[model samples]
Target: MTNDPAIAFRVTALEDNQPNGREPILGGILRKKAVWVDESLCIGCTYCSCVATNTFTMEPDNGRARAFRQDGDSTEVIQEAIDTCPVNCIDWVKFEDLDDLRSQLNAKTIRPLGLPPLR
Candidate 1:
C-alpha cells in the first residue's frame, strides 16, 4: 500500500461505505452490477469473504476468488466484496446503467494511486 492519504482514505471509505457513500445497484429491469475477480492476480486471500461472505467464495481447486448472487442479498454486499479485494483485480460491468457503481468505486481507489482511471 502507498502512503498517500487519498489512497488511504479511499481504502477506508470503501471498507466502511461512508455516508453519502456509493450504493450498490440491485436487480431491476437493468441487470445488477457485479465485481469480476481475476483468477491470475488473486493470491487466494479471502479478504473479500471477510466483508461479504455470502457474495464471495474461494475455490478450493485454484484458490481463486469467485462472486455470485446470493438470495436476498443487497447490492451493498457486493460492493463490500469489491472494496475488500487486496489485489484490485475485480472489475464491474453495468448490465443496464451506463455508469456502473462498482466501476466507479474501483476508479476512486486507482485515481488517487496515480493509476489510470478505468473506463
Candidate 2:
C-alpha cells in the first residue's frame, strides 16, 4: 500500500434530487474523513451509487461497496454520497463546518439539466 496520505482515495458528496419525490436539496459533506465501508454493515444495496455513481461502485469480487473514484476531494461530492447512504454507515467529522461544503454542493453558478441558472 502507498504510504503517502495524499495517494489515498477520498470520497465526497454531489447533491442531487431524492428519488422518493422529496424536495431537491443540497447534501452535506463527510469532511476530511473517509467513508468507511463496513462489509458487515452494508447489505449490498446500491443506494450509494444511485446518489453519486461517480464516487461509488459495487466491488465485483466481494459484492460489497467500494469507492469508485479517489478524485472526489471536494466537499460537494463527499456529502452527497454520505447523505444517500441508506444504512447510515457513512458519518461526518466537522459537521459544524459543512456550511462551506453545502455552498459548494448547492452553488447555482452552474446549472444542471432541467434546472435554470441562478442570476
Candidate 3:
C-alpha cells in the first residue's frame, strides 16, 4: 500500500464491484431507503467525499460531509463511501421520514471546526 493518502477505498477485483454495503434496494422505482449523512455524527474525515466523488461533498463552513446528490454515483461507489466512513455517519433512511429527521437534526447543536463553543 502506498502512503499517498489520496486513495479512499480500494476495489481490488471486478467481483468487488458490487454494492455490498447493504441489501439490494429491490422493488420498483419507489425504493424506501435512501442514503443520508448525519452531520452531527460526521467527523469531517473526508473519506466519504473522496470515495464517492459525485455523491458526497464537504460543507465548506463546517468541514462536515453531506450527501449532495442521492443518485450522483453508482451503488458500488456510494457503498464504498459509506463503508469507508470511520464514524459511520452515512446511512440509509426512508423517503417519507426525511423531513422528520431533518427537523430533529435542526434541533441538535453543531460545532464546526475552527470555531469556539458558546458558554
**What are the clash counts of all predictions, listed in order?**
0, 9, 0
lDDT of 3 by residue, 1-119 (tens): 66865554663557555443333333334544778899988989999989888778898878899887766666777888899999899898887877888898889999887678879
Which pairs clash inside model 1?
none
Cα lDDT for residue 32, candidate 1: 56
lDDT of candidate 2 over 11-108, digit per residue (tens): 44556733331222235433355444544455567777666565567766546565645334344655777777778755553535445544653453
Considering TM-score, which of the candidate structures 2 and 3 is the better prediction for this target?
A: 3
Task: Give candidates' CA RMSD values in order.
Answer: 19.2, 19.6, 12.7
Q: Please report, in order, the local distance difference test score of every candidate based on alpha carbons.
A: 0.57, 0.53, 0.79
TM-score, predicted candidate 2 vs. hidden true structure: 0.43
Q: Kindly report which residue stretches of model 3 are placed more than 4 angstroms away from their true locations once superposed.
A: 1-31
lDDT of model number 2:
0.53
Top lDDT prediction, candidate number: 3
When 1 and 3 are scored with TM-score, the better candidate is 3
Task: Give candidate 1's root-mean-square deviation (CA, Å).
Answer: 19.2
By TM-score, the best candidate is 3
Error of 2 at 52 (Å): 1.7
TM-score of candidate 1 versus the correct structure, residues matched by position: 0.48
